[model samples]
Target: MGQGETEKIAGELIRQAVMLLMDRNEDITLSSVLNILADFQMRAFNTGQLNACIQAIADVSAAKSGSLREESALKDKVAGKCSSCRSSDNVTTLH
Candidate 1:
């Protein structure tokens, strides 16, 4: 899929996910995300849409003018940050 189409799908997914979350009584959960992804996926055996969604996320993260870039900068500017993010960065995948 083209970048534009990917972006549109991403936007729609985000909108739906936020609504899904708001309808829930819990603090946070990935169930909504999973539900939305299940719909976006192609055949049960094909992960093409999921992979495209990942690429779409990376594209937005790499953009110079997006909220992600702004969030990154804000994260760096904060002092005495928690270790959750740092710990996540330290994760090592066994090959």
Candidate 2:
């Protein structure tokens, strides 16, 4: 894929991950980011694409987690749903 296409894919993956967190009323934290990244790693993404996707996720995750409160509470919430969490399948690819 071209650079633009890779960027688009990364953006979509980030959106899907964010939507999943939002739908579950969860804040985006480091654990959330790791969970989302784990889901993506289960797919057949190329190295460059995966790197881009990870970077995109990290960027958005940092922004979202900026106002995190009560580290212990966040940890509990993250641990609760992380075991069965999966990234959304709302991906869009160039044909």
Candidate 3:
């Protein structure tokens, strides 16, 4: 199957797994969840199938930034402070 199709399937599987865990009042760690998905993939699909699904789910849930403006701003602020002294020297000015 195509990458998109694989990702779609993986995403659905992850969603189902999440719902199942939630329904059972179970708290699953990332590793455990991945193991469960891997098992499901091994039995139901081919290699890399489960990984693709998980990636798809992550892609959907993860935040998307159109630009690095926020990151840059934070960096600018941090750049003003010295790592050792925490001093804002003239050369370390933010602006």
The candidate scoring highest on lDDT is 2
Which should have the higher lDDT, number 1 or number 3?
3
Question: Candidate 3: where is the Cα deviation over 4 Å?
Answer: 45-95
The Cα local distance difference test for each model comes to 0.52, 0.64, 0.61
Candidate 2 overall lDDT versus native: 0.64
Lowest lDDT sum, 10 consecutive residues, model 2, at: 86-95
Question: For model 1, what is the C-alpha lDDT against the true structure?
Answer: 0.52
**On residues 4-43, what C-alpha lDDT tens digit does candidate 2 reach at each position?**
7767877777777768888999997657855776688577
Ranking by TM-score: 2, 3, 1
TM-score of candidate 3 relative to the true fold? 0.45
| Predicted candidate 3 versus true structure: per-residue lDDT over 47-85, tens digit per residue | 566567557445533422322555665675777743344
Task: Tell me the spans in candidate 2 whose CA falls farther than 4 Å from its real position.
Answer: 45-95
Ranking 2 against 3 by lDDT, winner = 2
Evaluated against the true structure, the overall lDDT of model 3 is: 0.61
Clashing pairs in 2: none
